[model samples]
Target: MSKPLSPSSSYDLHPSVAYVQSILANLEARTGRTLEAWVALARAEGPSDGKARVVWLKAQGLGASQAGLVAQRAAAGPGHAFDDTPAGYLAAAPGYVEAQYGGKKAALHPLFERIVELARSLGPEVKICPCETIVPFYRNHVFAEVKPFASRLDLGLALGDPAAVADLSGRLKDTGGFRKKDRITHKLELTGVADLDLALAWLRRAYGRDLKA
Candidate 1:
């Protein structure tokens, strides 16, 4: 597993966010240019199209991965979703969750909060990492995610082999499979607080599976 964001920091990060931060943190060391410099280069000289800019950066001597990262930052420009630094992104985490539950989805905030409470109760290691749309709950890995809809929420779980789990026989819908590279392999649609009991049960199972793995 990767190291925590900081020795004294209390926040837990989603794996994808962590990966991007890792790449950005090392950008200067690997390419001799900061992310700001790379974005400026891409905007000034590279193609305007994002994919084309990645190719252009690669041709200009950046590795494939670094080129892709630079292209993404350039395309997003200033005030990007994850921001320009790890600390900045971490600071904006709460706003991300608030955005997801705003407007027509505001009514679902209570349900999302309840789910978060249950997820945290599982263990202290359970980190609530909110992205633009979904809120992913991570244990050793991402065990579950809570995605809000205008009228309902989808609780996604990474249950290993849903077919073998009798308790989840018809209680969840398949989210493809790990073999197919889907981190969340099943989901339960929750319309209200009444649906939480079943959701909590399935969440516990998913968390336990990740714990053992």
Candidate 2:
């Protein structure tokens, strides 16, 4: 099941925020330093380059992933806060689909909006969240995502096995498949609302497989 949303985080209602909090909570025990401590060190009591900070963190015994997270958050600079809700994220996140659609891709907004409407109607158990750069629809786990581009939208579905869904080959793009992960194994290009209807059947299939009733 999706984890319960946090009530104390900067972006308490955002799944990403909760996920980040969980990661941070384990940082002190895993690396002997809290996120705050690492950020301060990244600042180096003055200022330091990202590569230099990562190197220093590595010297202090942190693995590549841990050091990278620390270096990234540190390099992000101060006051980098997440929105408290999906709506806010949609409105504020850089390169949000709506922003992309509203800007150079205005002609694509109606199509994306239609897709979102259909996705939101999936079921009561589903959560439609706007993450930093993507709109993810989740059941107990993420089953699909709608990623918009300057020209079109990429509809991602977490269908369990690619071979079993061969009938869907005409619409699937090879680029987004996660062969080893299996889930989110297909991506379909969406150019208009007419595309949503065709995608719904597979979306339901993905939801059925990835999300338990």
Candidate 3:
């Protein structure tokens, strides 16, 4: 028999823009990673401490705050809110803080700076997330258009070296179904179904129910 989804359950999506949102939502819940916690940690603790925490994260084979961003949501308490009604009241609108401040002061040794910086080198598409980065799990792709795919490999491996991004491109390539890079509109590389499920599975494994799914 086929193995059941471990920690991750299959999502019911309509294969449209809503599908991307669904995948991101599912991914955030499945993984315990969240931007809220990362931001709070960075803001409260000194940069050294933030970097130390990132070291711990790297040891685990993921970037510090980037993992949560890749999953597209914050860690679920303070810095961001889930997309669900009533709950999302906590999450900030995109760039609201930045616009209010009207400037970004660079830090020489910010905690998650490196992790987030390296992530920028990886994804071809990055946009200000309409949702919590921890939940969406990666910066939203600015697609001139969106496309549908059966799996996540094409986007993850688009930059040539899959290792430059996530670790599993080679592995995901062996999937039972063939994936495509179908383009729609300007063809932004927004995610569809598979990656979201993977993120969700990863989340369930990380949080172990200490946090909500």
Candidate 4:
């Protein structure tokens, strides 16, 4: 028989596994069943996978959230939502994107919306996400970011060859070695949609450069 999962066993587990592990660590105290007990029940239900196993656990009398955690543990073993996967992180904080533009920051919502619209048009491969601090625009990797300030929005782009975009230095302004290793070597300030046309043009070129790289 496999050894039971313990909270201290989460050193190298996936984010989702580690996330579930924390809450379920004291499983028997709360749910009246140890982690091993839950998995044994799930396995007894016969061969299954993913949501199906979760559904089975729920029908077996575990509450929805607990069942979901047990099913995930049964399938993949120990870990937590902070493990590293983008989906895992998002699952842990579903309102992260909305919270970024809520309250006093609401004034910048439209600006981020416009940036997202343009980012989506880049291609099917583009992933616009709030990674760490900045909302990064990813094409294979982060090719751009939309960071809002209380006064203006800073649009960062990765155009690879700095010289090719150096002519815009007076307009776009060099990032002055911020995250120097990143392809996002330039930034433009935007106060409103009025700046969208020029920014979009720069992003289009940056997208091409990112794909080529």
lDDT scores for all predictions?
Answer: 0.79, 0.66, 0.30, 0.67
- Weakest 10 consecutive residues of candidate 4 by summed lDDT: 4-13
Model 4 lDDT tens row, 1-213: 123222122112223445555656666887788877888878777357878888787777777778877777677554434434444565543244556667777788777677777766767767655643457777766678877777778999876656666554366877854446756788889888788888888888878777544
lDDT of 1 by residue, 25-79 (tens): 8889988999899889899998999889988999988888788888887885544
- Clashes per prediction? 0, 1, 31, 11
Residues 1-213 of candidate 2: C-alpha lDDT, one tens digit per residue: 123233121111346656555666688998888877987877775247878778888887877767767777778663323413345553454344445556677787666556655655666667666554566778788888888787788888887666676753488765445666655777888886567777777778777777465
User: lDDT of model 4 at residue 118?
Assistant: 75
Which 10 successive residues of model 3 have the least lDDT summed?
A: 6-15
User: Backbone clash tally for model 3?
Assistant: 31
Identify the leading candidate in terms of TM-score: 1
Segments in model 1 whose C-alpha atoms lie over 4 Å from true places: 1-11, 15-18, 76-84
Candidate 1's TM-score: 0.84
Q: Write down the worst ten-residue block by lDDT for model 1.
A: 1-10
